[model samples]
Target: MKLIDTKNQLNDKEKHIGKVVGVDNATLTNIQLKAGEEIAEHDSKNEAIIIVRKGKVRFTVEGKPVEVTPEHILHMTPLEKHSLHAIDDTDLVLVQVKP
Candidate 1:
């Protein structure tokens, strides 16, 4: 058995990215962004699920804006283009599963 305290992994960096876990078929990533920081448009080859732990973020998926908060979760299909801007200091966990 193992335990991971996600909050303890946060740092006061501009765009802090940390790996929580990686295995044969899945990977877990931690992403922390300061307000106004942005992640450039990109596409992932694997299926993805993004969980917002705190704060707010605006995700532009295929040219549409989607506001995400702690109460929301986002999922992306493989190779779906997307980009995000931090509306507030944000913490997100991304889980990707191999096909």
Candidate 2:
């Protein structure tokens, strides 16, 4: 198993406001998000899970908005369009299953 510390991942300035911790089988991935930043709207044909680690985020699934906190885990089914915005400085782990 590959071990990763999401916080230790390098931030790519040209990319979005988050870093990819680990990816395998092109299915599962760990992501980290910063404050005032966002993961733009996108869609996938597989299910996904978002686990909040350190802060708040405004997450939208299929156009419905929901607030995700450290105590919450967000899950999305196949083909659902979704996006996330950091409400404050935050950290999140996104696990996506490929179709």
Candidate 3:
């Protein structure tokens, strides 16, 4: 069992996008992007959900472009190819569930 204050972790330092923070049965990742910053295309072996914490981002999911704002929650199934770009300064959290 584990409990964490993810916000506290954020306050400790600013992170680059797609940084894996913690992992057990799942992965906890912290993503922060400056305007024009991007994470290149990649596929995940596990299912993932990306929570937009601040600003806006562009997601390319399976070759489709998706605009994601702080109000949206993005889900990616296992083995899905995805990439991200910041439309503005952004903060996001990626939670990946592993098998």
The CA lDDT of each predicted structure is: 0.90, 0.71, 0.81
How well does candidate 2 score on lDDT at residue 39?
A: 84
Tell me the tens digit of each residue's lDDT in model 3 across 28-92.
78778777888899998999998988889999999999989988999999988998889987888
Query: How many Å off is the CA of 57 in candidate 3?
Result: 0.5
Clashing pairs in 1: none
Of the two candidates 1 and 2, the one with more favorable TM-score, higher being better, is 1
Give the candidate number with the greatest lDDT.
1
Higher-scoring candidate on lDDT, 1 or 2: 1
Clashing pairs in 3: none
Which residue segments of model 2 deviate by more than 4 Å?
8-26
- Give the per-residue Cα lDDT of candidate 1 at 47: 96
- Candidate achieving higher lDDT, 1 or 3: 1
Model 1 worst lDDT window (10 residues): 5-14
Per model, state how many residue pairs clash: 0, 0, 0
lDDT of 2 by residue, 13-57 (tens): 422334455355445455555677788899887688888777799
Better of 2 and 3 by TM-score: 3
Q: What is the TM-score of each candidate against the true structure?
A: 0.91, 0.73, 0.80
